[model samples]
Target chain A: MAGKTPAGSARSDAVRNRRLLLDAAAEAFAEGGVEVSIGEIAQRAGVGKGTVFRHFVSKDELLAAIMLGMLDELIDTASGLTTADDPGAALKGFLTAGVQIFVRDRAFCEVIGRPSLQHAEVRAAIDRLCDVAEQLTARARDRGLVRPGITGTDVALLMAGVQQTAAPLLAAEPQAWRRYLDLVFDGITASTGRELPYPPPSHLSLA
Target chain B: MAGKTPAGSARSDAVRNRRLLLDAAAEAFAEGGVEVSIGEIAQRAGVGKGTVFRHFVSKDELLAAIMLGMLDELIDTASGLTTADDPGAALKGFLTAGVQIFVRDRAFCEVIGRPSLQHAEVRAAIDRLCDVAEQLTARARDRGLVRPGITGTDVALLMAGVQQTAAPLLAAEPQAWRRYLDLVFDGITASTGRELPYPPPSHLSLA
Candidate 1:
């Protein structure tokens, strides 16, 4: 393929190399952490050092790309998740799957949490995630899967909450996060099958 | 008092100044943001610039102290809140109070969210928070206020999520966060005054 000069071949090779670098970079960054070097990513990808820099201008860009890839995966799954029979079930599945992604891919999730990425391009990528959330949330509510009062902003907050919920999954107990997700889902989700465990009038309405 | 014991008086004054500086530092960082200067904080607190340095060696230290103070307030409130009729109700109150603190005192909340402090003291404070949440969750379950299957880690994540939810409160729509909070509470709290709002499930169980 490299020997041939087809019109789309170079772009395809570049795309393929970009994916390789992103996957390798994510693994290296997760294994060695955020401070891991570019050369390490290159070595892991089995690509030339120049190729890594060629695909990404700097370490920050590379890390950002790796993160963008994960975010894309997350958003894509969210988009696909809306097609389920029950919107509530789909939303819960989306939340659980996203949590699993964060637990499985720590460095990628840190793209949003890390202070270093407060820079422009990374901020844009992170900011764009809100739209993804907004759309998914709208779809869920429109389908009657979400609580009636749950607006786009509300779902976004819950999404952030879910990420926070995933932290413990990596720590002392992995299963603990699942329980957390259940609590959260129960809070927002109306009781259909499970007896509503929480009684009414418990919390003083701040309103 | 000052005339009776000069040394004791001076020490007490120093303590008062330190508290003032800490408060000033928290406000400055929250209002203007993380990059605000030490001199500015000293000026805000009506202290000499040197006194700011005397109290905290670095901005990071000041931020950490501010976080410690905020966490202290939260823990105290959470402790007091557990006395509600149902422990589950107490947990909800504490969570609401925590949200109010983070929203009302963003600078301190931002200070706690800082990555720098996550290493030592901050991590312990978070662990202690989890402990409080764990006990609260367990007690709520025993009292049957918590929807069954809820866990401490979920509540912890929910607290962090609520804080993040409150961050854009000032710049966004008025009471947008309040709506978010309402929807979130709907999910976390048990149904009251009305029937569960969703379709009935084929199988249901709650202890």
Candidate 2:
């Protein structure tokens, strides 16, 4: 701390405050909400309220940091799946990984849908994650495992669709997400051995 | 307006205030957050501050009513699908119908992972909806139209999955849900000539 220039000292303080704020914000948002007060966060971080304001600039900025932390874990885990030996397995693994992550971080899930956050950087992250989903679908198609018409975007929706039942406060059983996964997979995975007994759809139409 | 009994008149007033408060709260919650004030809701509803309090025990109760209104429509539409002549058609029709209803009321979507309102009645309504979803799967399966291994819960999750993409805010872009439906139908449908070109999975692992 002694030899550092004023600028260097400021940079180090910023980094320390960033981690402290993130940890504090995550706990608060989970228990209260993204609207949890900056004062409460400063108190929880054991820093002066002025220190909190200096670091985040605004409440929106602090919320963004908390969400970024959550998204980082999701992106990193999903990224790992893209490197798995089997493409289908990688995609499935990522879905499961995402589910667990979402379940654990309700605050992140609650705010991830905000259109205001649709900045260039967020869009890039989305596109990269989407590419991961696409690779999984392409791999399945190439291996002759998935059905004919499915696309990567389809898988993205499918991922989002399944997570619907995983609402944190539905007051059902905790394993509701497991049930959601089973059904979602049933909707995508090809039926290999068993012949479906149901009648064929007369036609497929969006109407 | 004058013909009603004293108790009946009070109930009617209560209902009107409830509706007014709910409309205001829904708008506020979507624009702001759950921390939105009762006074703001009263102003939005063009009612006295006392009227808002008279109808709702708390802001939480007002939010719950909004959620219930949306769920009621979903449960009714889904249940109605079972009565259609072609179970397969009914399944698709109702699944799509349910998604439409869900999309029509995006405000309710906000309540998913948020704090609980009251429990007893709210839980019952949710269970009723789950039952409708389960029934959609069972009936679809019974007709031999859904895959052999698929269940009622499967259909519910599939619909919910679509909602995740075709959500209220993103309502204009419903192609995600459509693509998801295609994947779902392809996986579970009895193969006809129009099948997509995915490889048959060797065996689906429970994972």
Candidate 3:
């Protein structure tokens, strides 16, 4: 492996640079806004502006990449949770992960929060997240941990609730989301036996 | 009244046109987005473009007016609740009104949903809303209807959660917010007795 050709190392270097740029961009956008310059992002990544453009043609594309990357990471996390010994804990953990992401990526939250402004990539990511959520929630229900009559849409609503409600208070209380999530978990867990109001929310049908 | 002078009728006509333009702009903005053209809005209002220009100097001002109008309506609604016989019911009704507003006014929802984008008018509205929410929640708490230890911020989070989660589903099912609101209502009500997770949310400082 040490004797690998220059091209192979160059390719690996490119991958590392791209990841760095995405991380840098995410931070810059979250800290400032979408208006952060590409050159600034490249500077943060310790790469040339040409290298940044080489990875993502435009800032919008860079934003899309970050969103897709977050969704892919979420999907990976959700898939891995299937093996967890406690389905209930896995479900709770999934929601907590979502809240953390919302807190971490204000840019991503801004995009997902508005329907009028969402691009195709954002919708795709939400659909994929919804699928993963449905799977884990089903497992929790099967284990008698999650309350009956709760749907994937309800789970989506709960995670979104935590995100939107907690994001603003992060400066004053970083862990505000945790408390809200617990109240939500208690409400939805089987122990509560709480019946949701009639005529459930619009089915988040990905079909 | 029928014998009113010509000048009096002309003044009434100006007032009517202003109301028409505002209502039309609100509908157009909510239906399409904040980008809806003034000419298009005037067309919807059955008025000329000059009428719109006469009422609003620019689109930014128009948006501000709409936001202030919403806040004024919300403050009015909240104030009216003090007359209700049941404080708990009044508090719940206030939240329900919020959901209905979010469902009815997409432009308003977009404005209120993002803390970063909010201007002075929106912040003032939220501050007033928080005050009203505290008053109603305190009354409800005294009546043993609202659960213990819930603050105005908690109530705000719950309402924001419902509005954010339910806004997207309005197209598929208009009453979708009602279901989620009920779930939230249950969680916060005395019947649940559900202890919130440790380290509660940031204190919503009204002082």
Tell me, by DockQ, which candidate is best: 3
By summed lDDT, which 10 consecutive residues of candidate 3 chain A come out lowest? A1-10
RMSD of 1: 9.2
> What TM-score fits each model?
0.64, 0.72, 0.79
lDDT of 1: 0.59
True lDDT of residue A77, candidate 2: 76
Error of 1 at B6 (Å): 16
- Model 3 CA deviation exceeding 4 Å by range: A1-17, A32-54, A57-61, A114-125, A190-194, A199-207, B1-17, B32-60, B190-194, B198-207
Model 2, runs deviating above 4 Å: A1-17, A30-33, A69-80, A118-120, A168-172, A191-207, B1-45, B112-115, B147-158, B168-175, B181-207
| A96-189 per-residue lDDT for model 2 (tens digits) | 7766655555555555454444434444555565566667777776876565555555555455555665553234444556655554565566
- The DockQ-derived docking category for candidate 1 is incorrect
**Model 1 chain B, poorest ten-residue lDDT window?**
B198-207
Residue A109 in model 1: shift from native, Å? 4.7
**Which TM-score value belongs to model 1?**
0.64
What Cα-based lDDT does every candidate model obtain?
0.59, 0.58, 0.72
Q: lDDT tens string, model 1, A7-104?
A: 34467778787778777888888655566888888988889999987766678767766666666777777778767677667777777776666556
Task: Kindly list the per-residue Cα lDDT of model 3 for residues B1-207, writing each as its tens digit.
Answer: 111133334577887887788788888987875668888998999998877767677676777778778877977898899669999889899888877776677677656656655666667777887778778888898888877888766776677677766656655666777877877776677355556666655445311
DockQ of each: 0.16, 0.24, 0.39
Better of 2 and 3 by DockQ: 3
CA error at residue A55 for candidate 3, angstroms: 3.7
B-chain TM-score of model 2: 0.69
